[model samples]
Target: MDNTFARCEDLVFSYDDESRDVLCDVSLSFKRGEFTAVLGHNGCGKSTFAKHLNAILLPCGGSVYVDGIDTKDEERLYDIRQRVGMVFQNPDNQIVATIVEEDVAFALENLGVPPEEIRERVDEALKSVGMYKYRMHSPHQLSGGQKQRVAIAGIIAMRPECIVLDEPTAMLDPIGRREVLKTVKRLNREYGITIILITHYMEEAAMCGRVIVMDKGKVLLDDVPKEVFSKVELLKSVGLDVPQVTELVYELNKYGLGLDQHIITEEECTEALIKLLS
Candidate 1:
């Protein structure tokens, strides 16, 4: 199996001819079945970059390829979209049908999938997100988390090779956020879907296999969570916050406390502090 799933080469994007580049000479690759989190402040071009993956936005210069299909080619547009699915932040905006199962079936219906296959796909998608039992329920009656899971199920029913979520948890409460994140992680782990999560939440980013920190439309850091979060000052310089536990250890180290350099999680911080005392 090939490791590379998505590739961007010298990708430059701008909204209009008069506007400056939103993404400048950005080149990166995402591996298959890897969960990657993209972190950046608003207007820093993370979402713009994501839009290129599905050809919602094409590069003003350079190129983007999803599963090796060039996005600039009109002939491959449908195939490119089928290979990558996108889920946005708002559940209300995403939900199209009244019933959960119907909403999941919407995309399949558009694709002209046979009714029998649509039923099988919808049921499998709903079950994958733990929302199978709620298939008959009205989408409006569901909680934010449940609605978002239904939204995800809609994408899953398409059976895309990759799923790109642009702040899918932004509008949800803590519980809703957890539910969506868990469902996404499960999709990557159990179903082997490549996940590209664009989020402002540091905690959410921590759960990814790789973290890419963008600033002023360019990648400033790309590394594993520990390495990326370790540079407390660098993250702050880019108008981003470290995870609470990481910040705590960083402040403690500033006061001459000895904690391991790689602490990113609360569990790791607690264990390190306990060992230090012992």
Candidate 2:
């Protein structure tokens, strides 16, 4: 069904002739317009899993279906890529054009989209990412946050059904991180684009509708953010962290504060602390 935009079954992959699996029996599904975050410590295969969504890496022993088309089908690679756009850690690496708008139009142009349509798409995508006013400016002059937004606009110009961002904010400062995160959330809310964000930042994961935590090439937890972050010990055991607010509440709970361990945001933790004091 189209309602389910992406699906992966028993996905297995490894480098160097399949000697070891980076992703082990990983099966997940994404419904249309869902905003989900994937989290894990380093070398946990979260990025590897993201690559499979857009066919950057084919599954070794299983299948990945994007919009019901199999990713393993060599003939359908283009179709699969068109449906799921990928954004990566470094904006500098993704931005290839001199001007912002030209960069956004690059992908569609490569696809041989008509010039008129490419222009229209580029304008819309730039506006969506709040980068339209910088359209003609050289990308070298933009800030890190602005550059990353331009990169996102390029992906949006391709008109993909879903966007898979692998640590998109990792290379950014706080402001840059906020900018990219805000743009992605807006895309999900306004345009109903499915979002799969792979992030090391727990606060970013807290904003998503669902969280999937991977460890040692396998999914360790899959649930709503509050539920996933509540397992403080479990997450810490695997070298991962909860949002700062969640960690604060978790520590308070250990000291007889009796605060809800499920708090994932600063507001929630603050309210809980106030209630305990009262």
Give, for candidate 1, the lowest lDDT window spanning 10 residues.
12-21
| Candidate 1 per-residue C-alpha lDDT over 108-208 given as tens digits, one digit per residue, 9 for 90 to 100 | 99989999999999999999999999999999999999999999999899998899999999999999999999999999999999999999999999879
| lDDT per model vs. reference | 0.93, 0.92
**Model 1 off-target regions past 4 Å?**
none
TM-score of 2: 0.97
Candidate 2 least-lDDT 10 residues: 12-21
lDDT of candidate 2 over 1-278, digit per residue (tens): 45899999999999876577899999899999999999999899998899999889998889999999999898988998988999989989999999899999998989999999999999999999999999999999998999989998999998889999989988899999999999999999999999999998898999899999999999999999999999999999999988889888888778887778889888887788788788
Among residues 3 or more apart in sequence or in different chains, the pairs in candidate 2 whose N, CA or C atoms overlap within 3 Å are none
